[model samples]
Target: MTLSEDRVGMDPITFCDASMNLTYLGVKVSPWLGVNISEVGSHLEQVLRRVGELRLKPFQKLTLINKFLIPHFVHQLVISIPSRALLRKLDTSIRAWVKEYLHLPASTSNGILYATNRDGGLGVPVLEDLVGRVALRAGVKYLLSEDPAIRAMATHSVLQGKLEKLADSLGVKWPCSLTDLKRVRKQQKSNILRAWAAQKVQGATVDIFKGDSVGNSFLRQPSLLKPTRFKTALQFRTDTAATRASLRRAKIVKPGEDTCRKCGETQETLGHVLNKCRSMHERIIKRHDDIVKILSSESLRQDQLTTEEAMLGLTGENLKPDLIVLSQEAVFVVDVTVCYEHKGFVGMARQNKIARYTELQRQLKSRFNVTHGEVIPVVIGSRGAMPAETIKGLKKIRLASKGLLKTLSLSALRGSLELYHSFMDR
Candidate 1:
């Protein structure tokens, strides 16, 4: 079925995306109204209570934790403290006693590392990743399930041109609503959202607007935004400016004040350092020679595929085909990606607008045809920079971004190039 605009959930809003597209699988997060809680504590308490009861069949199998649980513990780091008197007293008392009583080594005197955390100290699950996953689940539920409010919102978006609703209609082939517009359900709870539905197109239809019609809107550039960290509609609705603004004010980042050590020119931005500056470009060219060899050895046509460039299509319809690998017998389309978004950070996931990213990937995948048999969509994003939530949502939406294949971040491209060169030379 085609993706619908309303089906795209609040991820765009959470991540402050101007536009987004997403896919929702129909299995887990149906409109069953069973797996949602407004409060985090309440949700956790219910889960624990369910484990204790064990009588009622709770959805253990579908739980995110159960699906993507990790076995690791926190690594404890100690901040150095001054004052020889205090240090000496503690060392003579508790430190010496613990070492002697427990028969522990000198390194063990630092503290305890928990079992859950690989390095182990405080057993805290990564909260930001957890939030991002929650956001994804919410998006899935909002789209595939029978949540009337969400459905109404979707419907309104379809009725409006904000979303490409016709795609869903074409893809799914089902009439959206069973209700008659003639009847007025004044008191119905869903009516609240129905009233809020994006207004109907005024006396016009989308069929007239043809493809490539929509110039840049919020879905494209979000030019209206003043380059702020948090500009999504959800932030405005939830009044989270203070919280979001704090991130923009973070001093964790070192200023981009590095003059190129080699060229004596100012250097900044990962992209500029890696791709643009002439000195770095020369290094990259030197490195790419190795990649060229790999491509030749594989007997596959080689091409430089940049993550930023769209896949190009040689057909009637424009397509941004990233890499076209052809070997007389087979053809394959490859899409390379690098993400700069700080999704792995503690709070970045829940608030990510990954829906748009998910949709774009799907569209690119769908466009592949000239390829041999299996139309390959090669994708790679940073291990930590991309949120687990984004990955989960993308998988659910059917545009999975896999990493098992060789993927090197632009930051490490130089190293990767050298490694590739070394291996090939050997």
Candidate 2:
């Protein structure tokens, strides 16, 4: 009795069949279906094993997923395009694993988890979307190969005409290269983001390309701060995590308990925790005032202000900025807010300050007889959830050093926590 006949309950195998399926480089291939679905079980199994062995922080877990799990699946798709069904299965598995690892509620939305870290999300790349992007990149790279032999072979292929027409439709100029294609795709992506932001944020003027010296400094000098601080700063700016509001939104807390545990009058929302909630008022104000005082001193040393004149609202606009620096070239209007760590709240805090002071900046410029200045919006989280943009704003105004910013922000966060717990326990 041969092995085929002896196979108990398994499907019958055709012996000596030329068209029998074969496995190559982790992919299954058959003459009929061309490429049968490859088993991705091993890929996920490895990650699951690692996840089980180690107790990791939420951000650390995100790092593990991005560094280990994502690359495993991405490499496979780059080699052979998988079916959307398979891609979705992999994505679901990864997402579930991330939720479990982060100890988040099952109700956590994909938008929150998969959003870029800079945008107040976990920054988990969606597998389904990544697979498609990888496939597109592969096709474009191959189609635009510079090798004569490769071009000849690709031109003879069925996808050639379609790809060329697609490229043409994309407005690829004659004699275009791979670089040109990538540039066009990048521009398209930027346009999409602009459109999406405009649609989602009412009255939002999408100016992502606009150069602000403060944002540029934060982005450029990342090494000036610790990794955790940098990451926290980014989260605060984006309004993603480590805040009660964010946790509640992720369903990690009961809806009723979403109100301030100490005050019990207002919702425990980010804005409430940061700007309202009388229970934490003193700490919040102290945090802002401390940062402002530090920036004010620095501005005075730089000769940007007279005795922290602009910061004290003694010199201009009836507006008290955390600090203000008046240079020969420009005058900076700086304000400070200690925001909740939640992404939504961080964004609101920054935006509110900007909106509140937009007219103030105009007023200061006209009233004080100063020109060539900018508004510096500095927002920090009580528990070290500082905004990178805040640092940039400080630097733009020559107000605060990176070390000072980190120290003051973290101290404020610690102080706020002490007050919060005391209030709650009392």
Candidate 3:
């Protein structure tokens, strides 16, 4: 039959004609623009519903969103790119859900929401960013396919052309094969991701210490089942506790509670309470002594280093080493102290403590008649903060294992928390 004669006996629906919108396989196709955004929107709605239903901690919620929610949308992202407006809406809904989950104020910065866990953030994955990442990954897979059909499809794809153009624009050598493309993609992704995180975490109170085993270990530790324990660990790691300065910074309390009730003069900060507060002298001494004891026990077990001796005072001076080790190669004077977790300050504090004991080291060397002597200063922050130098020193001294460092870091944090509570009571 002719086309006009066929239409004479049939309605649009009877002929299976699509007028404005058509739904097939969960995707809504628009006839005019031939765009498939409704499917993405529906998938995003399901993700947001699951997010809203979760009754979990901030970190747990973040984990769920990244693991479950992102993947659900990414399945759709693999097929087509969601419009910018749709992406923005999805982001808004997810952020709102996160804020609701955490009971955060409306004013919380998006930067804090998306920053890395090490940068003292909840580290919620961004939907827009995840979509782009998934698209790039899909493109990489297509380029690596051995099937003739897949290879031909990739060669004709707009994404492949764009990638080549991007390489040329950046002065990067255009990738010729799947392996070279994968390598280039990996490098580009690493640089982009690092820069993205750095931008978000810039000017943040928390500091980043790359290649810091202690920090990495703490972050990688097994999850705490109890919410309280989990939150305490997270707070200590992120520096988000209800410290006087933190409270003041959040404007949760005014100038009244901002000042140290212990010293009654200086502003109470995590650094001050952990390091410089004179009122907590006894507790600080006990904390320092406790950590020293642990080190001494470890040092004594080593055959190369002799038994560690503690509280060795320099005659006619207030200078005293917390622990001293006599190794066959060198005499090691170790001084342990608690200080701020700030990366910059931790190094300075370590160096300052080492410098203070230089004269004492000389005196001890002279008295002991030791030719090779070195001072090893271990400065741990009250909140379980360990300096990179301290980590290196610990490893150098044969205490590098993950279990040992993790135990040490956790112990210091618990001890510091107990001391912090006592100060609060005072």
- If scored against the real structure, what TM-score would every candidate get? 0.23, 0.59, 0.73
Consecutive 10-residue window with the lowest summed lDDT within model 1: 72-81
User: Model 1: runs farther than 4 Å from truth?
Assistant: 1-258, 263-271, 285-322, 325-332, 337-426
Q: If both were scored by lDDT, which would come out higher, candidate 1 or candidate 2?
A: 2
Candidate 2's TM-score reads 0.59
lDDT digits (tens) for residues 338-409 of candidate 1: 322222432332333232133444444455432332233322222112233333433432333233112222
lDDT at position 12, candidate 1: 27
Task: Please name the candidate that would achieve the greatest lDDT relative to the true structure.
Answer: 3
Tell me the tens digit of each residue's lDDT in model 2 across 209-241: 122223223333444344445444444333443
Q: In model 1, state the lDDT of residue 333.
A: 41
- Name the lDDT of candidate 2: 0.58
Candidate lDDT (C-alpha), each? 0.29, 0.58, 0.62
Stronger candidate by lDDT (1 vs 3): 3
